[model samples]
Target: MIFHGMTVRQKALDLLDSGANGADVARRLNVPRGTVSYWLHMERSKRNICPGTRTPSCHRCDGVGLAGADYVYLLGLYLGDGHISQPTQHRVPSMMITLDDCWPGIQDEAGAAIHKVFPDNATCRVRKPGCRNIKVYSKHLLCLFPQHGPRRKHEREIALEVWQQELVDANPWPFVRGLVHSDGCRIINWTTRMVGGVRKRYEYPRYWFTNVSDDIRQLYTDTLDKLGIKWTHCTRAGKEYNISVARRASVALMDAHVGPKY
Candidate 1:
């Protein structure tokens, strides 16, 4: 490896590599016979004659990239021994993961379904008393669920929200349903608005719950009082606030009112 330390020899060797013969190198350097040969042999050997060394990250031969040996060495580099840290739970790479690839418990459930439909294939085709259509098309039943490819980000967001909505709707209690609906719907207070840009009193004017039903409103009020929600109840009867300010105040009231029903 000390052969790497000799700049002149290395240069000569490089020139040699670029089709410069031994005689050409000898002629250029004006060296006698066998001196270049000795240098070449010294390069081939692993003796540490020079102080410095070429610490190339290779397990195979140095100073010369031999045919296919270099390739094997490269392969060793490619397939390294470095260990990867495992996650606390099973972790999948994101890119290759489609909906089908990451279908939470789908595969096992599908397999069970398949097995249920098609128990012991040998007996089933003989048309026993319990030979249902499922038994006839066992393979078809096994592969019944179609392969759903990767949904894009927007699709996934929509799917998740839809799933959540479905879950909420499926709940037995009316209060829970109202709470879920409230979560989805925006709040609006009964407030006044200037009619057609005129500098006068707002056309629509009142203070009532926007989205919530009567029972929901009552429930909200009761929950808020229990949770000590500082809601903006009318201390003054005829107080006029700007539209934006009123909307914000309404939101605050709603937040305090709908503290944490879920």
Candidate 2:
């Protein structure tokens, strides 16, 4: 059986019992180092457990496999705009992805994707004064997204593990679709050009993905290359990379794979 799925304190004690360093647990769980220290002290002193504390009801079955469309899509979403966080004083371990509220279809898609990965867990959505978010509570989330840690995506060396690379290579469209949905935009480009001695205006569709993480950007572009989709990248003023797919043929392929969000 899994050694986790207990409350935060229990998980901390278990990790320590398993010989994991307190600092490593803190970083992995995105908790303050002091909090880990406190848990260790409390466990050592054999203090009375909190009255209401209980182990979570775990419906987890076999380990989640990574070779599925849902997993790849979720992976792209995480690489783009998703985040996982440790439990707070009033929360459970959760993973959340917030998308622009304007794209209701994309919001639904994100929720569906989350459900696809964690079929046993219930996914919830929030819509109000800000973007819409799809969130779910599960300690097993970290098992699926081990790349998770403290810090922004750009600050970390984000690279797919070997199994993930193989899965992504096998089926890349859904992964690309998820990343574009999260961090890219599809728009119509308009420009004027001299046509037969007269100025003419024409409109063309394009897709642009912008991110500060060079590794993620490279990963995206490399995936596009593997799919034979043409793209180009340029650096913006503030070091942000803009990867664009605007060529007629490239846009056609994107239309088939990464359509507009909403």
Best by TM-score: 2
In model 1, state the lDDT of residue 142.
11
lDDT string for model 1 (1-262, tens) is 1232467677666765577767888788766436666665466345432211222211122232222322221111111110112223422111111112232232232233323322322112122242211112211211211111234222321111232223223322222223322222332334355767864543321223222123323333443344333334332345421111134454455444332222
lDDT of 1: 0.31
Top lDDT prediction, candidate number: 2
lDDT of 2: 0.79
Each prediction's RMSD over C-alphas, in Å, is: 28.0, 11.4
Q: Candidate 1: which pairs clash?
A: none
Task: Please report how far candidate 1 places residue 163 from its true position, in Å.
Answer: 28
- TM-scores for all predictions: 0.17, 0.73
- Per-residue lDDT tens digits for candidate 2, residues 1-262, read 3233348768877887787888999888777788878777566446432211222222233443543787788888888878988978734478889888888888888788877776656788877576977888776667667778889989998888887787788879988998998899999999999999999999999999998889999889999999999998766786658999999999999998888879
How many pairs of residues in model 1 come into backbone collision? Answer: 0
Q: Which pairs of residues clash in candidate 2, taking residues 3 or more apart in a chain or in different chains?
A: none
